[model samples]
Target chain A: MRGVVLHAAGDVRVEERDDPRIELPTDAIIWVAAACVCGSDLWPYRGINEVTDPTPMGHEYVGVVEEVGADVRTVAPGDFVVGSFMASDGTCEICQAGYQSRCAHVEPVGRSGTQAEHARIPWADGTLVVTPGMPDADLIPSLLAASDVLGTGWFAAVAAQAGPGKTVAVVGDGAVGLLGILAARELGAERIIAMSRHEPRQALAREFGATDVVVERGDEGVERIKELTGGYGAHGVIEAVGTQEAMQQAIRSTRPGGHVGFVGVSHDVSLTGQELFYATVSLLGGPAPVRHYLPDLIDRIWSRKINPGKVFDLTLPLSDAAEGYAAMDERRAIKTLLTV
Target chain B: MRGVVLHAAGDVRVEERDDPRIELPTDAIIWVAAACVCGSDLWPYRGINEVTDPTPMGHEYVGVVEEVGADVRTVAPGDFVVGSFMASDGTCEICQAGYQSRCAHVEPVGRSGTQAEHARIPWADGTLVVTPGMPDADLIPSLLAASDVLGTGWFAAVAAQAGPGKTVAVVGDGAVGLLGILAARELGAERIIAMSRHEPRQALAREFGATDVVVERGDEGVERIKELTGGYGAHGVIEAVGTQEAMQQAIRSTRPGGHVGFVGVSHDVSLTGQELFYATVSLLGGPAPVRHYLPDLIDRIWSRKINPGKVFDLTLPLSDAAEGYAAMDERRAIKTLLTV
Candidate 1:
């Protein structure tokens, strides 16, 4: 089997690798139908996160179950599935509370690499959500998006309480942030504000239901959102960019007592205690529990209720996974899908 | 009139001052029947907070209104009232959302010195909750406690989502923390844990419905709490201590998806974004909107449903405000009530 590996910073290679097999009774092997590069994967690709050795890459995947271990009950061979990056038992107390990402026995699928010919998923019953049927060739990207980004954006919207009467704001124009705008709109937000200075991302943001677009950044950006929201700031803010500036903007652009659902992987960000305290805002976010939303997201996508798959601006064959990484790293693609 | 003034660090003088009068159409003059030295006041008395230009101190009080401004409506002369440290215009959006501390027109009652014989309360209608009737003399201290500490504790418990089947933990053992335990019990939490090294505070905690006590500090303290909760940490943690260590402890002691209600006035603390992100905990707090809970807390105290007044272990005449401050600063008293 061939797989994507990162040997060092800015080095992504698709090389022949040994096939994965069931290592646990709870595991299932899947033939990779679709895999995508994630925003977080860029961390190690850009060297912000170290890659001491050739690290297995790719966690988001939509595929067909090729085989299942003895313990697997819910999913069987030949079933088309969408799974989150994190695997969980789903029955654990945390998973029961809709936070499967923090499950008691959680495992990351990146350890096995989904950007390959085949992948092994642990906690099969809990990790994989079967689609209604084999999706159309064109619907593959949307199902793949549900494996991570789309699910994550929906979780963020729910965390930020973006629903009726809410003025929702998106701080990052990345794939997840744009999807958050779509999710917020679907959740009935009264207005959606997209903060972007980039023309291409701004256009997509408007298409995703952004009532307004502010070309400002940082303090000026926060002031612009506040100005647009009658000076109280947005009721819900989604921070998809993990940098300190983006986190502060998300926190500052929320009204007092409002909610900020920040899923951006925080890198070198330290939230000032006093300022946050006085803001009286509720802060909740992290790596989203994508598995909890895969069923619903898939249902919506299969019914053509939303077009989150449009986030994948480019798609390449598995052999060309390197270009997929480079495209996202250079901001040339909103998201890149790797077809297997 | 006389009031407690911090002339400089460690200087608490009850100096003769001009009687307060309405300076605005919304102001009211109250003859303070009961006022208390707060844990926060010790910050300035001990020089943790700067004492610049003789700060008039005291923000918690329950008194009978001596006179009302022309605009005062909800509260009038001769009405005994319980008011929080922050005065807010109840009509503001934030106040309407139950976060009065961040109201657009909020004012700190500390500016007018509640410890004075005659104190001017701004925004009288929105700031004061009149008692059902002239309270029995013995209920004065409990009512005073409700003005801030009890209300603050209730807010923290609510923020932590302390209710049925939840395990609530309190990090601070001050009057507020003890009352937090009480609040958790009242909110239907299944179990309450109080972290206190002091035997007296532990006793008070148990009396306030704490089912367990841990004397460990910092990391070990968090470990003890986690161990007590079947290794999942508490469902709700009240961070009553504002230090960085306490904040981190509160965050670490909460289970994934749990809530951390921190009301401690953080002095120089900064929360690392990554630690909080991985914890996947919800953090909500800051100068509690005590005014929102003041009426309900007052009703409970007026009916003797709770005994929060016991927290004031020492009492002194208004003229002996210096002793009150010294006793609290030296930890000789849990809290001190100043009788006018």
Candidate 2:
């Protein structure tokens, strides 16, 4: 089997590796159908996050179950499924409370690596949501998205309380933010504002139902959102970029009593308590409880209600994952899909 | 008329002043029956908040309406009223959404010197909530508490989502935090934890329905709370102390998906976005739209359902307003009520 590994910063290699096998009774083995490079993966690829030794890559995947351990019950061999980046036992109090990412028995599958020919999915019954019947070949990318990005965007929109009568402003033109615009629209937001300077991403944002697109970044971007919402700011703001500027922009763009659902992976972002307190916006976001939204996201994709996979601007064979990484790093592609 | 004034940091003076008169068409003049020193007042008195010019102090008040402008409709002369610290027109979209503190026509009546023989209240109709009738003298303190501290604490509890089966933790030992304990209990929280090292405040907390009292502060306080909640942390946390340590403690105490309602006036407090994001606690708070809660709070106070005035440990005539400030600043009094 071949798997993606980061031997050092800027060094992504698709090398031979031992195939995954169920090591726990609660685990299931799945033959990877599709996966993609995540923004967080860029942390190490860009050398911002230290990579001391070779590390497996990819935490997003949708595949066909090849085998299941004795305890696996919800999924079976030959079943098509999408799993969350974080695996949980599903029965824990935290999982029952709908925050599977914080489950007591949580396993971050990102460390195990999903970008491989075969991967072991721990707590399969809880982490993986099986798709209805066999998905169409074209729907695989969307379903794969449901595993992480799309589901995450959906969670961010939900956390932001984007619904009827809400003017939702999205910060970030990355794949997650683009999908967030689509999710907010599907969630019944009256207006969706996507912040983007890139023409291609802005075009995609508009296609995904962004009622308004602001090309400005940072403080100016907030002003644009406020101007669009009659100087009161949007009722909901989705933050998909983790930078301090983006976080502050999201907070400032939301009206008082509004919600800011931030899914961006925070890095070097220090929020002034006084500013957040004075903003009076309810802030809720983190590693989104993606598993909780996977079933619904997969349903939407399967029903062709939303095409979140459209975020993928480039597609490559699994072996050429390096090019996919470089393309996204250089801002040449919004996201890249690696076919397994 | 007489009023409390700060000539400089720590230089409080009880000085004669001109009687307040309605100036704006939406204004009302109130003959203050009772007022109190607040935790925030200590900021300037203790030299933490700058006081370059002589500043009239106090924002919490319940008094007899002396006069109303021609346009005032909801409140009139001869009515006994309790108003929020921040006067809002209440009809604005933000007020309609229940965030009166951020109302477009907001006038912080605090600057008008509520702790005086007479004070002018702006947007009288929206800022003042009249009691059923003039209350007995004994209820003045409680009614005064409802004007700000009680209302702010109630908003904090509501923001924290304290209710049945929830473990609500309060992170202030001041009048507001103690009132928050009572508010959480009123909101049906099964367990309330008060973080206070002060024996007097802890005793008051237990009386106000705090089921647990942790004397630890900062990280140790968080550890105590986590241990109390079986390592998962409280379901709700009310931050009533606006400092970096208190804010961090509040965030750390709350479980994922939990709510932290922080009403403490943020002073030099900065929140790390990474810590906030990973903690996954929903942060909701500000000056606490006290006007929104005044009616309900006043009713509870008037009916003797809750004695929020117990927060007032010292009582003094309006002439001793300077001593009142000194007492709270010297930590000799939890709260000081000034009688006019």
Best by the lDDT measure: 1
TM-score of each: 0.99, 0.98
| Local error of candidate 2 at residue B132 (angstroms) | 0.7
Write candidate 1's Cα lDDT for A1-340 as tens digits: 9999999999999999999999999999999999999999999999999999999899999899999999999999999999999999999889998899999899999898999989999999999998898999988999998889988898889989999988999999999999999999999999999998889999999998999999899999999999998888888899999999999999999999999998999999998778778888999998899999888888889999888999999999999999999999999999999999
Candidate 2 on A18-66: residue-level lDDT in tens? 8888899999999999999998899999999999999999999989999
* Each candidate's DockQ: 0.81, 0.81
- DockQ of prediction 2: 0.81
**Whole-model Cα lDDT of every candidate shown, in order:** 0.92, 0.91
Question: Where is model 1 more than 4 Å wrong at Cα?
Answer: none
Candidate 1 lDDT, tens digit per residue, B96-117? 9898888888899999788888
Candidate 2 wrongly placed segments (more than 4 Å): none
